[model samples]
Target chain A: MLTTLKQHIEQLVPLTDAEFAQIASFFTEKKFKKHQFLIQEGEAAPYEFFVVKGLVKAYHTDTDGKTHILQFGQEQWWITDYQAFYSGATATLAIDCIEDTHVLCITRANRELLCANQRKMEQFYLKKSSFGYMALQRRILSLLTTNAKERYEQLLLQYPGLINRVPKTLIAAYLGLSRETLSRLS
Target chain B: MLTTLKQHIEQLVPLTDAEFAQIASFFTEKKFKKHQFLIQEGEAAPYEFFVVKGLVKAYHTDTDGKTHILQFGQEQWWITDYQAFYSGATATLAIDCIEDTHVLCITRANRELLCANQRKMEQFYLKKSSFGYMALQRRILSLLTTNAKERYEQLLLQYPGLINRVPKTLIAAYLGLSRETLSRLS
Candidate 1:
């Protein structure tokens, strides 16, 4: 798991052995069973998780009990209620394990301290945030311009293995299509 | 205009006058007339603009010739075809002046150099990108969970003066509401 993290960070900025050891001290590892909640709505989101194994999803449950999927975290992906994490607000999005999972977790304070001390880590995070913004921009464009069918196709193309990994109903929800509509499209 | 840029940067990260001057040297000021293209589809996006005055919007026109609003840039806001700017791709979105506009423009190469040289500016940009990501997350949620009327009300709350400044048709387009529907809601 630490190797995965080291490789992920090194993709953006190479780290010395001493630097990696120091960085590793800031994060702790945790595991969850499938269907267990990593974060719950209305509770403080104390840490952001970097998935070392398995899958999780962050979603909002509307008043009508409809689940709106905000994002999914698979191996090597980072997941959290970022607004809540950064602002110290209660989580609006709940994250739960889609499969039995292991993740490396870092609190906001530690993450900030790490960045303040390390220019390389700061650069890595800056790049990650920019790419995250770009991905969301693309999602917004797809929502605004594409029909359900086209959205499904776009999602499939963007995350090639996602269709097989995620349930069709959840995929439908993610694309803002009904299960019937998504079935037809598929 | 430089004062505005300086103030904007200072809000996130305080800088000495000498530091500000060095930072300002990397940006060039440009002006545009209303409806003039700041960026056009299929063209290279060479610079990202920080609006010092007036308004601009970025939108994508689909194959069917329908326009989808991505974002609006008012005073003190940043605007660019970010995917193109960062990835060296041709622009998919067109950004145009909604009012006569003035902006400070920075090329990607200069931005990289600035961040490499200035820790304060790098911190400022990281903070800006994180906030940008959070705003997009909210927009995604609004699109997923809210009706057009609800979205319009949320937008009104978020940018109180925007309705008066922008045309009703454009506002309608931005909210994904038909002109008649937006008129009725208003």
Candidate 2:
């Protein structure tokens, strides 16, 4: 289990065995059944999870009780309400497992400890954070300028594997398009 | 001059005098006249600029010849085509000064050196990058779900100072609304 997590960190930066062990100590292994809530709106987000197996979705609910899918996280993906995590404020987003899942969970305290101890660990987190930032930037640019069809095409390009993994309605919600519109386009 | 740069870096992470000097050594100061192009589309983005004075805009021109403003940089803001900066790719975006500007510029090579030397520098950049990403995420969500007027309202709320600093046309482009539509909304 540590090996999987270590490999993911190594992809961002090379870490010595000791360094990896230091990093691994922060995470506690967890499991969730389908539809389990890993996080909830209006609660303080204290932890972020990395998927060892299965899938999860992060989403927000509108005042009207409509759910908007923000992102889907599968194996090797990290899931969190980062806005809340970073701000140390109440979460506006919720995370839930779409399938039975195993994860490595890191609490806020542990994350701080990791950053304090290992230079390489901090660098690894920074690189991972940068990747998330890039993805967010691309998504924003697309939503601003692209039409529904164009948005779908870009989504296809960005997450070719995701189409097979998640349902169309969830994809529609992620794109902020109606299911009928997505059905027509498809 | 160094004091001003030190303050800017400290906004992200508090740096000791020695650490600040080490990071500052990588930057080369330069000046540009108003309306001068810092970067042009189809060229390599050689360096990222740290503005000490005046304003700059980064934009892209579509096939229709209409320019879309991605971001505006005022004093202490970092400016570059991040895609080019990170991947060593040619820039699709162009950057230009709106006013005569003094900037501290860092080459790609020097940037790598800074990251290599200091874990704090890496973490600082990561924090800066994450803020931009968070902004982008909010912008995307707004664009997809909100109308032009609603988006304009959001722009005002999110970047009130920027609204006053830039022209309506640029604001319109940034919001992905036409100039005429923006005028009508106003």
**Model 1's DockQ score:** 0.91
C-alpha positional error of residue B183 in candidate 1 after TM-score superposition, expressed in Å: 1.6
Q: Please write out the lDDT profile of model 2 over residues A81-102, one tens digit for every residue.
A: 8778879999988999888989
- Weakest ten-residue segment in model 1 chain B by summed lDDT: B169-178
**Deviation in Å, model 2, residue A30 alpha carbon:** 1.4
Q: What DockQ do the predictions score, one after another?
A: 0.91, 0.58
State, as a TM-score between 0 and 1, how close model 1 is to the true structure: 0.98
Give candidate 2's error at residue A62 in angstroms.
2.5
Scanning candidate 1 chain A in windows of ten residues, the lowest lDDT window is: A156-165
The candidate that achieves the highest DockQ relative to the unseen native structure: 1
Encode model 2's per-residue lDDT on B70-116: one tens digit a residue: 77888888888877877888998899988898999998888878998
Candidate 1 structure quality by residue, lDDT tens digits, A143-170: 8888988898999887778788889888
Classified by CAPRI criteria, candidate 2 counts as medium
